[model samples]
Target: MDIRPALESDLPELLALESQSFHSDRISRRSFRRWLRHHDRVFLLAVDQGQALGYALVTLRRGTRLARLYSLAVAPQSRGRGVAGALLKAVEQGARDAGALYLRLEVASDNQPAINLYRKLGYQQFGCYEDYYEDHGSALRMEKCIRPYAPGGDSRTLPWLAQTTAFTCGPAALMMAMAGLPGGYRPSPEDEIQLWREATTVFMTSGHGGCHPLGLALAAHRRGFASEAWINIEGPLFLEGVRDENKKRVMRIAHRQFVEQCAAARIPVRHADIDQGQLTERFQAGANILILISTYRLDNMKAPHWVVLSGFDESCLYVHDPDLGDTHPRQAADAQRSALDCQHLPIARDSFNAMSRFGSSRLRAVVIVEAGPGTAPTPAPAT
Candidate 1:
């Protein structure tokens, strides 16, 4: 059997194979035809003696390095003939050639044979959805890094810990950064609250205060990590929302205290902007970054939020968002499973730079965490 791109003439067999492979969530003939003509979508088929055996469909988005394996189906007669695997391999190559660094897919949870095949082919489960299929079955989300390997530890291994509260994104993000290093701190609710208590600098309009860069940097340093902070503006931050002079005064005092504490602890505080190129370089050099972004791009809210810089590809940057808003609000039991979709979440390089700035003044803040004393920089993974 030979694998190749699907042509318009292959539509009838493609629809036939798709119907025989799955009982629900079948792709429409129109979608198949449209994707075949689309430049960013890859549709391929495996054929033997001009008989279609299997097919795979991959979708790519502009300005991102991610590809989604939208569908993969093999004819019933082609079972155990490695047709499914060959179709999948063809899709991966097609996706990579189109500039995708990763490929993601969702498979039914109860499909053990398909799951086994995916695992054997290097796809790992990252997240899942409950009652996802038309038949109310769960769907397991899986992904593979299709990009060529580079030096340094893969940041995708870092745990995805969502913020327990709306106002604790800063502390929650710092917790994830610390947890990514060798002998890193284990994150828990207790630590999350304590870090918030220790780092909060500005009292917001209603909710608990937002954290300052110095506050979070000092908190990480106290936990024995080497931390540095970069801020685009000088003086008190997160103050534009405050209407009460008393509250603003309090926030200013808190910011001053954090600045003094950071200085006494010998943490570097660079009062300048750190661009995306610099962030990518630091991340590749084995440091985890805690960056502040405007929630407008992420959730349509004009507010500040925090996330960890998990990884970077040629055209995209991946983040572990502490906010679970990417999906619907989830129960605690489902948070872990839902977090898979948010882990190593990709953002276009240009979009990330724009999202990193917050508020009308367009503030940018970052906390860079290096390995602690006596802990060498994380090494590259064993192939």
Candidate 2:
């Protein structure tokens, strides 16, 4: 077995390997030729016994500090044999040598095996797009930062929250608690609400930039509450506000951003249009959940993050905001209105109702799980 730079002679074999490894809509021979012609492109092939086992094609954009893994494939017979891993490592080294700061790729959402492999290799999920692929399957965009090698610190160390119970409140509380300190601290009830707003503000303004949820979600998950976010809005926002040629491009960027956030925190995020019945059906399948209902605060007339959906009784829903604290689980006339206000989305109750009357637009609740019943819950930090 040998790993080496791909030659012109390898194109036919490479194309065959790609077709066998992927579905019908993958890269074509013409596309492969164009990539090979690019000055910054790096294409590597792994062969054993004179047959192509796997291949990787990477393109470096010097000015943008980005290197994209355009195509990667391993023969079906060669899978689970480390061929893919070897090709990936070669691509990483090549990208780094080319002075790229970030490496990016897109994989199908349902491709869990590939997703896990990328995660293990330090690739973080950034976002996803609905029907981004030719077959209309969702695609997950992932990235890996190429930094100068540093020594001494163990990369696998769990975050400080995992080491101690200093910040062990629920998602919202934990985030507000952390905002009290320059680096980390606990906040008062008033401060908690303010901090929660600030943290989420950071997320929205930054376009959800970090590798994980900006504030409370990350803090809580680190301390053992498995928390996730449900993004509810109108039909495929990515597909809206863009030209046909650029729709895929925009969606790819949007999805990559969200997926990276979830990947950073090891949380799952489900994207859905509330009008879709299937979305709500999937949301109800989770356990120990908390729903956040966003609404505009009357004082400012600006939509701010408000209220947590704790649970529901027939005809009425419950919410828990930091401001309300233990006296939460408030009632709302309509559950959909509660969801809309919390998210600050532009859809009106009447308009939303008109579209969702026959169906439900409620966003999926973020599921939270405690470590175990035997373990005592960590106390919140003193304000």
- Which is the leading candidate under lDDT? 1
> What TM-score would candidate 1 get against the native?
0.67
Per-residue lDDT for 328-380 in model 1, tens only?
A: 33323211234544567677678888888988888999999988898987743
Model 2 lDDT, residue 201, Cα:
22
* Per-model TM-score versus the true fold: 0.67, 0.40
Model 1 regions more than 4 Å off: 1-103, 112-140, 144-156, 326-337, 379-383
Lowest summed lDDT across 10 adjacent residues in model 1 is found at 327-336
CA RMSD for every model? 6.8, 20.8
In model 2, which regions exceed 4 Å deviation?
149-383
Tens digits of per-residue lDDT for model 2, 1-383: 68899887788997898789877567778777766665677789999889899999887632224567777899999899998889999989887787655677888999999999999999988567677777889888787766542211111111111101111223343443233222233444554344334333222221321111234444445544455555554232223223455544544554555456557866755554333233223223322223333232211212123223222212222233333112223322211111111111122223323322211344322333333223333322221
lDDT of all the models against the reference?
A: 0.82, 0.48
